[model samples]
Target: MRPQAAGDLVHLSAPASASLRTRPGLVVHRRRNLSMAPPHVVVRRGLTVTRLEQALVDSWPTLPPAERRAPVIRAVNDWLTTSERLAVALESAPKLVDRGALRTLVARLADGCRSPLEIWGHEHVFTGPGMPAFRRQVPMRLGLRTIYLDMFAERERVNIELDGSTTHGDPRQREIDLRRDALLATIGILVVRFAHRRLVHEIDAVRRETLAILATRRPGVIA
Candidate 1:
């Protein structure tokens, strides 16, 4: 996770500390020394800013339209506006890169989402395995109330859960999950269980197993 950095941090020169003080909702980050240029721009905890951020600013004035629009070039410009003194700092820094070629390549690895395939809530439902479909966290019934599921897939009423190591360790969690599954079963709703590692590492195998179960429930769907 990105550490809470002051939204308004300025670059500090070498041998100085980076700090932030939050006021209201905005953060004011600055270095101990005012005149010295920062050794480099850093974000989060001990993570240095990428060469791309530096390169873009250093050459922002001379950047051609095509070069400036490049992925790393663009990312650098975005960072400059948010980070103070970074644009000037970049101007004085050494050339971290010659061209933003790799950045462009990585940018192309987008989800390329089309109609009916985009996620409604990325915080909950996520993309996985070839980034094909949304991994819906199936809601489960526990006793008289409803509970949020860690991972879920639903077919009619059957909800499948992928339990991880963390889940089995908590006694209270285990009991709750067990009760939910049992309740689902009592209501004629199936709950197929799989290990989280299996779903992530051996996704195709898991898909095959899931499809097989679905095939059994509705035989003609596959044929």
Candidate 2:
């Protein structure tokens, strides 16, 4: 059993049996099939435990709504698991609580959204009518250095970067971003950035601005 952030509760899964007993600080989950295939279960410190993807899906419902997405997102970002594997684990848990939300999140991750801010932008601002289908996490080579774009519109040669809250206050990060943008600009890719605050609070405005920017980038459109 994995150590939780809080509480002494230990969750264990076993094949369905009438002899199972529940006690304080112990949670037993009886399943028709308790045995997991190879690679899905690992022997850790002499105890068998579900892999990261399976454990995430199985424990999704137990976490608070706000806290649930972080672990899954972090796991994916850290290369511990992929969105594809998570989707497979999710399929095994049809009755899981808030399953639809998890599915949506996985879909966004599969689309190359690496952060919560980008996910929010995808769902709220960067989509819908007149918005081009943006390719995300696009790689571009600038000599020896290669950089990945957050969102790229191929036809317009535009890149929209979603800046997090901490980015604005960090001078070093801002300098890095500026230099990166300059490099991208040399290749004719226009970089447009929106901060976390504006993206969340000014949804309609950001969408309008993005559309207008894309329009200006078109072949015959006037700025």
Q: lDDT of each prediction vs. the true structure? A: 0.44, 0.89
Which number leads on TM-score?
2
Which run of 10 residues does model 1 get worst, by summed lDDT? Answer: 112-121
Task: Write candidate 1's Cα lDDT for 119-182 as tens digits.
Answer: 1122222444322232344455556787654334344344556565575568998897787777
TM-score of every prediction relative to native: 0.38, 0.90
The lowest-lDDT stretch of 10 consecutive residues in candidate 2 is 1-10
Candidate 1 error regions (>4 Å): 1-135, 138-143, 150-154, 219-223
Model 1's lDDT to the true fold? 0.44
Highest-lDDT candidate: 2
Clash counts per candidate, in order, are 3, 0
TM-score of 1: 0.38
lDDT score, candidate 2, position 217: 100
